[model samples]
Target chain A: MILLFLSSGLFLGWSLGANDAANIFGTAVATRMVRFKTAAITSGFFVIAGAVLAGGGATRTLGQLGSVNAMAGAFMVALAAALAVLWMTRAGLPVSVSQAIVGGIIGWNLFTGSPTSIDSLVKIVSTWVICPLLSAVFAAGLYVLARAVTQRSRMHLLAEDAMTRAALMAVGAFGAFSLGANNISNVMGVFVSAIPASSVHLFGFLHVSSDQQLFALGGIAIAIGIFTYSYRVMITVGKGLFRLTPVTALVVILSESLVLFLFASESLEAWLISRGLPSIPLVPVSSSQAVIGAVVGIALVKGGRNLDLRLFRRIAGGWVATPIIAASIAFFGLFFLQNVFDLPVHRPVVYELSDAGIERLRERGVDDEGLAELGGVAFKSARGLTGVLREKTSLGMIDRDVVVDCARRERFVVTRKRIDTLDLKLLTVGQIRALRDITGQEFNYWWELESTLTRESDQWAMLPDTRDNHPANKKLRSNLRQLLDAFRTVDTDD
Target chain B: MANLFARTRLLESKIDEYLNHTSEVGLLFREAMKNFLDGRLDEFEERRGKVCDLENHADELRREVERQLYIETLIPESRGDVLGLLEQTDDVINHVKHALMQVSVENPDIPDELGESYLELADYGSRAVQELVMGVRAFFRNTAAVPDHAHKVAFWEKEADKVAERLKRRIFQLNIDLSHKIQLGDFVMHVDSIADQAEDVSERLSISTIKRSI
Candidate 1:
């Protein structure tokens, strides 16, 4: 059953809630301004709401890193990442699920011999660096702003205290919401490719897609984690960071929420695109890093002399180590899952060099002399296709590239009618609108249609891309127009 | 959990006890000064011993409070503030003990003309300390009243300072040895410092109250 395979993802989600929830409400709860029970309940509710609502946006970028096409593979990847997080947490070291899951996905790619998209990898790595820096900037700005407002109000001390307590709770809830939106992908993202794109009807009234159901399940697991295990971590984080003033705590939480929101908000990205401006990537970022960055921002604003530089360095060291440790665990865990447990980790994907593959190769400028002899040939994997092509022809060094492209061509299954009937429930409203705008556009292949849809889709265009304009997107549009004209002329000849 | 909570409550009460014990230092100083002015060294020593005993009791309570603050995590959120307040408040008691010890050891040659002034100075300092003690209690029980008590402490401190200045001027004009005059002046400064320290502690109490309110 899929439930068995889902256990690892659920476990990862739980750990994420246990660890990251502290970043949101730790200062308030530890300072006793907000009761722990109240903080936990509010966090549990908002985090799930956030995950169910906006969690899907960042999953596509994670899918680009590596598509673990089998449920078993996704299980092992999530398991390895979760184990890594648990171990680091027990060791009293800071670890983030975002970094661990990225490492796990990369390990799965390596184990399965899938080509890692360097573009996605670079984008993810860069965001890891930028997320914290952006948080620091936002935190510094917020700290100054909060100080000015409080000073200007000049309220009675008790009134100011009450206001600060209320603000901390409000900002903490917002931070929890942003955290769920950002980090849910790290928990449930590996299964994105494995989740079926069809909705299941429940009691003839509620229709839930596999993606939504999986996200909801992950959200619930996260909620359970927050309610059960977050208090101790909250205490540690709250006390470990410099003793936070109520105002400083509010500023740190607001800054963290803003950073996570910027990274995960599809609405903001869409607005940026509507204005013809480049949009922010919907990437799941580390909330722990963001919170630490905000605290550092406060320390800097407070003259930077009292910062626990040693603790900062240790935490920084842990950040560097988390991903590498997770990757190693995933890499080795894959072999154990596939061999020892005999699970179907990498599915057997077949590519045929039939008329379709040949036509695609010709369009790609492959030499046509010996390609006819390759008709009806089948390959079980990308390497198999490349090896067979190299053996059968005197093709030069680019033979593997051609075979890889041909294998990719085999993946396109979209048609005009299929795009017309494509499930809107599975897509954001912006994506649905983008698909509608491109209706009746002639595309011979699904890849062409998907790329066109992606370019037009506000959420997709803003996705973090390492390559400038991502060469694949540019080529898809050009090839689709050429193929459409060729189809037109051939119809006239007929 | 309830036990720990009760233990913290008990620790806070002990700290209040310490404050009460330290407050008696002012009363003891007045008593010891009376016996000293009356040439009753034996009586003064008896009361001085009582002051020392109270000081020791306060020290023990302070240590217990500090231990519980660490071990039981009493008032964890404001533990530092409580400890800082305790440490600073203890300084007033130490000043009381030192002033009394100096008077006993030095055996100041108080002229009959200055005996009433000496007693007046002691009375003024003791009253200021009592106000400070009340302010400290208010810091723990009724924060709003702390500033008022601190104001009262400032009033007594100013009165005590004026008495000290008058005593110094009269002692200098007594045709006593320059060294005796300086020693008496030193005694005057030391005794007046008790009120000054109480005012300082009350200022701290005000700040601590403000911190809690905010």
Candidate 2:
């Protein structure tokens, strides 16, 4: 049953592999610079390696887009996005998996009344435009440099040909690696929050988290897609759109690899942040778009006479079509999952007002007398609590947000030993040690532990009541509790 | 990948073979010019016939190279340049064939006073053709060396033209019949055009080489 739920995500991964892997090695294979077999093998191995090692960063951005919070909801969203991509590809449109996944996520947020994060949405949508333009600039610059070197050296034609062939293979492998690292999020990011909280030891040595396992599965699906269906796409990209010299082909591949690496590399983002520069949002962008941008860049540098605008227009049409179709599918699919199938697509999260919630509400200067009457009330989900408080009390969205601090229950008992053994993935070591200092303490409410952790970790500050909850903090707290629950020991002394 | 490069090399080999056939025409022209100067009409006819056969052979090879370039897609990036070069070089071959045919048909009575000058023009034309052949070879083998051979072709072509002009002046100054003098002048112009065609091919070879380099 659980395996069936994973099928849609696997399908998305497969289509992504089928379509996007072409962006990595299509020009090489199509131009006969590299054989299809060699391209597929290199791309398959490196893509899996990249997914297993570096696929974590982009998933964080997708999670911030909107956390679906239910396995059934995640499954439906992935299915909708996959179907949209498959349909677009079959129709011979240039579909971007990142765009489809985003649209599907937005659809879910709308269906569940979860407000979309406009800031993250704008950043991601802008990158879809920016990624290709950046690739174009990089490709043009590299092509000029490559041509100048080839001209100045005046290398023998055969020797130059050999060098170009070797360079294409090396750069193609780099492209495939970046493709897997950046795009695995489109395949399995929906399942991150719902990832099973147990670790699977491979060969009883390497500890593979459930998220990594999902990433590996998605990577394999991409590899399979590359092996089976990428050749046709490669042919189109390689020769049908524009004629490419071997050097131009290598430049295109290198430019695409660099762009993908920029978006997905956490270390690069950290370096930028350390320098007090803005960090790049770790969002999955379209590899196909990047490749096309590179091809166009080369065309522009060659004086812009060669671009097939009709073909490009058709591809651009797919970009607009993908998101709208994906959103529609997700919206209808969620409705079916919730109503017809009797599945909890949006799992109802009921919270009983606790002492900590009321105390936090009072600390934020909410009129205590009016909210006191609703002390013991149980509400289904944070939005439900906000809706009632709006009607009965003088609480605005901000005040309601503060009052809903304990809107979710925490099931973990954070004992000294439990905290010490916690396998939390997102929290830093310092935060974990601070969590450990709260020995023998039990947190039955969400706000109690959050307040205690904020006080203990001098590194973290409790958010002001007027502001919204930080997505990173929310995810960390949720992961910390799950880890504690997994290691929770029975208290016999009680 | 090596397969495509190998096929392109084969195409290049066929072009070299065609160039060799054109160079053979230049050799036959030189031999025929020697025989004509020595008053050996029979041997000149034989040499001219040989140039004709080589021209036919070179035409066949040129056709074959073009067909392979288009059909096999060998060296697709440079296929057009290769085909263009073949066409231009084929003109050099045709001039050899036509000049030799005119020599046999017109049977111009060369004045013994300008016999050595005719041979000089033939030698220059032969040298020009050789230089062009070398330039075309460098185009495929080492594109960077093409300009050097092209410059050599231009030098030999100028020398051939200078000799042809002197021969035309010597034929006109002779006390021969007016029709005979016109025939000799026509013969000299026909022979000089061979070197002129070679110089043109050399220029094209240089241009194509530059295109390929970039």
Candidate whose lDDT is highest = 2
**A1-494 in candidate 1: lDDT tens per residue?**
68888899999999998999888999888887677899999999889888878786687678767777788889988998999899889878766889899988888877876656667788888888898888898998898887777656644333344566667778888888888888888999888666444346779757665566778889899999999899999988888655877777888889999999988887777667656677787788999889889888878986896788998888888787888888888889889988998987876555556566677577757765666776676666666666666777777755555545555432233334444333345455775566557655664344455557668864545334444444434333333322222222112132
DockQ, structure candidate 1: 0.08
Evaluate model 1: give its TM-score: 0.67
- Chain A: TM-score in each candidate? 0.79, 0.83
TM-score of chain B of 1: 0.95
Report residue B5 deviation for candidate 2 (angstroms).
12
Q: TM-score of B chain for each model? A: 0.95, 0.93
Per-model lDDT: 0.77, 0.79
Q: Estimate each model's TM-score.
A: 0.67, 0.75
DockQ: which candidate is best? 2
Instruction: Flag clash pairs in model 2.
Output: none
